[model samples]
Target: MALPRTAPSSWMQSLDLPSQLFETGSTDYELYEEDDEFVLSVELPGFDPEEITASWDDGVLDIAAEHDDQQRGERRTYHRRFRFPKSVADEEITAEYTNGILEVRLPVEEAVVSGREIEIES
Candidate 1:
């Protein structure tokens, strides 16, 4: 499934809600799979390579970034969430930032039936 982008900044104004004075930026992402590993490509410009944060919960992956441009008097915060099909190996995950693009490799685990039979009425 393709990731969805947030509505335009004017959406709230069109709804007659109070304007959110500050500006909010959007991050774009692409998903793909290769050799049992899911590859996520995220575009985050003007952000330091070390400042982005990412976490996985259940099957959802959350990514957030903050960039402060003092020269232009602008600050931007971006966030995006993605839900993969199965659980990922957190320890084996790897991410790299290059040329404003963040590439992450999430190794997919094999499906295993998780449960145990318990004897009752002893």
Candidate 2:
């Protein structure tokens, strides 16, 4: 008789070894409203500004960074699991990195106004 096979636990399935061993962990992020735009700040240490990439699509904002192979030598192993939320936008977004921090500015779209005015019947 063969023993039954069991599914892996949620925690076990979410682990990414490559990211944990070599890749740095995901940076902390903060979002705030600024005037007519939303500002997002992410704390990324030991990361180059040119190595980061960010984009938004289908209500999800994707952020990814890969260390330079030539500059940093061979890719190191990682053991981390990170899941970033996607942005819900049809157009592409832009990001900037500076002082070990990444700042993203998103412009708020103006709300549409309906032309129909309700009249009171006395």
Candidate 3:
């Protein structure tokens, strides 16, 4: 005999089930410093370039996207903010979206680490 389908538990129903289940893994975005610039690449599969926006304020870079499908009655949104370790030239920042991937490049100002290296105990 087959088991009958039942409703979810009260606690489960109260959770953001869809988001938790459908969200991408932590590896969906990559950030790194290279060639005097901070590079960020994020995978946003279902959104179009027109629906995506990127902005820099102070030391934070904000990336957001929204998509709406009237026929399917569905809406999706993505938002993320990143703070760079070094000063960024906000005016030189640039972004590009292609092949469902959004790439943002932030030119970092002259930032050199000046600290003493601590010896580790064997």
Candidate with top lDDT is: 3
Computed on alpha carbons, the lDDT of every model, listed in order, comes to 0.83, 0.59, 0.86
For residues 17-86, write the lDDT of model 2, one tens digit per residue: 5443343444477887666566778777667766677766554556666665677585522122223343
Give the CA lDDT, 0 to 100, for residue 38 in model 2: 66
* Reference-based TM-score of each model: 0.68, 0.56, 0.71
Q: List the residue pairs that clash in candidate 1.
A: none
In angstroms, the error of model 1 at 26 is 11
Better of 2 and 3 by lDDT: 3
How many pairs of residues collide in each model? 0, 22, 0
Better of 1 and 2 by TM-score: 1
> Which lDDT tens digits does candidate 3 get at residues 3-65?
436544444555658655544444779998899999999999989899999998889999999
lDDT of 1 by residue, 1-122 (tens): 75436565645555665555534663378899999899999999879987799888888888999988889999999888988877788788898899999998999887797899888985
Q: Output candidate 1 Cα RMSD.
A: 8.4
CA deviation > 4 Å runs, candidate 3: 1-25, 111-122
On the 0 to 100 scale, the lDDT of residue 44 in model 3 is 95
